[model samples]
Target: MTRAKIAKTLLTLPLLSAQLLACQPADGQNPAQPGQPGSLKTLSAPSAAELQSLRSSELPEANTRFALAFFGDLLNETPRENVFISPLSLSIALSMLYQGASGETRQEIADALRYSGLSEAEINAGNLTLRKRLQNSGKGVTVQIANALWGKAGLSFNAGFLSRNQAFYDARLEALDFGSATAVARINQWASDNTNGLIPKVIEEIDPMTILILMNAIYFKGDWSEPFEASQTQERSFYKADGTTLEHPMMQRYDKFRYTNNTDAGFEAVSLPYGEAEETEMILLLPHAGKDLASLRDQLTPENWQSWLSSLRSRDGSVTLPKFKLKTERQLNDTLRRLGMVKAFSEAEAEFDSLLDNSPLKAYVSEVKQDAFIDVNEKGTEAAAVTTITVGATSIQLPQEPFEMVLDRPFLYAIYDRATESLLFMGALNSPEL
Candidate 1:
C-alpha cells in the first residue's frame, strides 16, 4: 500500500459589511486605481526574549471553550460527508483580524469565538504560545503553521493592526493589485506551497471590491511510534452507515495503548502516539453497536472531552482499522453568522475602523473558506488544513483489557498535540475512500 500524504489550504474575502459612508478624500489623496501595484512593508520582528515570554504565557480557558463550541456548531451544520477542520488555523486567522475590530463588531467576534474572559492582548499572546507549541517537533514528526495578510497596495491600513499580527502571529504582509490576474495566482501559489500541494488552489478569483485577505495554513506529518506492519494488511469487510459492505485494506496491530471503554458515553477510544517523542497522538473513537455517531458527538463538550482524556488507561490490546483518505472543502459564512457573528457580516453595523486610516472605509468579513486533506495507512498519518478569512466591503480510541477493537464501520477521530492538549485536527470517517 502507498504511504499516506496529506495537505490543505484556505482563502477568504469580504462579501459585504457596514453601509458605505461617503467621505471626501484627504487633500492630495486619490482613490485606488484598478490594477495599480501597492507598496509592501514588513513589520518589525519580535525578539527572542519577547517570543519566549509569550511562550511562557498561559492560554485562557476561553480559547478552549470556543474551539469545542465551534466544532459542535460546524458538526451541526454539516451532518453528512466527511468533516475535517483545523480549529487552530481558524482561530489564529480570527485572532489576527480581532486586532482591528472594535465595539459591537469586536463583541460579536469575541462571543462567537468564546473570547469572553480574555482581553485582546491576552488572546494574542495566547495564540503566539499556541502557534509555537504546535510547531515544535520531535524526531519523525513535522508540524508547521504559516499566516499572511494580503491587501490592496494603495490602501492605508492601521499600523497597530499590521504590527500586532506580525509580532504575535508572525503574519507576512504583502500588497497586491487585486484587480490583476496574477494576484490570484500568487495567493493560490502560496497556499499550494504551504500545504505541500495537497490543496493547489484556494480561491477561484478575487472579488473586484476586495481590499484584504487573511490566511492561516497548518501542515502535520508523523510516523506512528509503532508502525503497523504492511504485510499484515488484509481485505476485510467494512460496514457502512447504509448497511452496505465493502472490502477494505484493514491494518492490524497488537500493542499496549492508552484506552478507555465509556459505557455511559456509548463508545470506546484508543490513543496512538506518533514519533519517538510521543508528543502527538491520533485518537479513534468507535461507537457501540446500535449507537449513532451523532449521539456521541452531542456529548462532546469540553468537560466531557477532558473527562475522557483523564479517564484513559493503559491496556494491552489488538486494533484493526481500515486505511482511509479524505479531502473536504467547506464554506463557513452561514455557520459563523449563526454563531452570533451577525453584525460582522452586516454592511451597516460592522466595525473595523482600526484597520484603515479612512474611517468611512469600514471593512467587514464576507467569506470564509477551508480545504483539508488527510491520509492514514500502516506507516503513519499526514494531514493539512488551510483557512482564509476574506473582507471586501464590510463584512479516538480506546483500549481495554487485552481487548480486540475492530473498526469495521464509521468512527470519529482526532489528531491532538499532547504537549498542550490541543486538538489540531478532527473528523468523522464515514467511508474509507472519500
Candidate 2:
C-alpha cells in the first residue's frame, strides 16, 4: 500500500488587471488599461525591535479577525458554497503592498484588512514574527513561504518601500519584461515550486495594463498526530447545500481532543492536531442542524472567536470528516471594495505614490485574485492557496462531554498554528467532493 500524504496549503499573491476590474458591484468587473512599470531600490528593513516587542498574542488575533471578515462577506455572496482562505499569507502580501500606499488609499486598505490599532511598524513586525514562528513549527510538519515581486522592466519604485517588504516579507524583488512570455513562465514556476506543484500557473496572460505582479506563496504540510484508521472510512450521508445528499467517504475517529460546545452560538468545535508536538491543528466547527453556516458567519467576531477557543476543554469525542478535494478560483476586486478598501481600486483616487520614484507613475490596485486547493482523508490533510495580487490588486470551537461532531453538513474549519496563534488556512464547507 502507498503511504498517505500530509496536509499542505499555499498562499499566493498575484495581481493583474485587463482593465482595472470594476470596483462597484453594480458596474460588474471591467478591466482597466495597464498602468506604468516600476523597478525596486533598497532601504533599511523594518525595525527588529518592533518585531521583538510584538511577540504577543494580539497580532495573530488581528490576522484572524481580518480572515473572518473576508469569510463573512464571502458567505453573504454565496451562502451555500465552499470557501477556504489563508489569512497569514494574504496579510503578509498586503502588508508588503501597504508600504507603498498613501493617504486615504492606505487607510482604506488598512480598514479593509482590519489593521486598526496597529501601527505600520507593528503590522510589518508582527507579520515578520509570524513567518518566523510558523515556518519551523513542529516535527513531521512542513510549512514553506516564498515571496517575489515582478515589475515592468523600466518602471521605478521607492527604495524604502522595496526594502521594507524585502526585509519583512522576504520577498525577491525583480523587474521583469512583462511583455515577454518568459516572465510569465518564471512567475508561474515560482508559484509551482513553492506550492509543491499544486498550482502550476497563476496568470494565463499578462494584461498590458498590468504594471506589477506581487507574489507570496505559502505551502504547508501536516500529518494527523492521531491518524484516523483507514478501515473506518466508508460511504456516508453528507448533506449538501442544495438540499441533496451525497454518499461520500467519511473518515471516522474516536479519541480525546480539545473540544467545546457553544450552546449560545449553536455550534460545536474540535481541534485535531498534526505532527508530534501538536503545535498546529485543524479546528473544525460544526454548526447545529438548524443554524447552518449563515448563522456562524454573523456570529464570527474576534471577541467571539477568542471566547470559543478559550472555552475548549479536552474530552472524549468522535469526529467524522468527509474525505474530499476541491479547487477554487476567485477574482476579489468587488469583495475588497465592500470591505472598506475602495480608494485603492479607484482610478481617480487611488494612491500608490510610495511605489514611484521620479517617474510619472501612478497606480491603483487593479485586481486581486486567489486560487486555493485542499484534500482530506484518513491520513491527514493537504492544501495550497495562492492569492495573486495584480497590484491590481490588489473560528473556534468547543465541545466536550463525549461530543459526537460530524461534518455531515455545512461547517467551518481552520488550520491554526498554536505556537503563534496564526491561522494558516480557514474555510466554510457547504459542499464536499464525492
Instruction: Report the C-alpha displacement of residue 186, candidate 2, in angstroms.
Output: 1.1
**lDDT of model 1, residue 125:** 71
The estimated TM-scores of all candidates read: 0.86, 0.86
Tens digit per residue, CA lDDT, model 2, 127-242: 77666666666676777776666666555556787678677777645666677899788777777777788778888878776666777777777899999999999887787767
TM-score of candidate 1 relative to the true fold: 0.86
CA displacement after TM-score superposition, residue 272 of candidate 2 (Å):
0.6
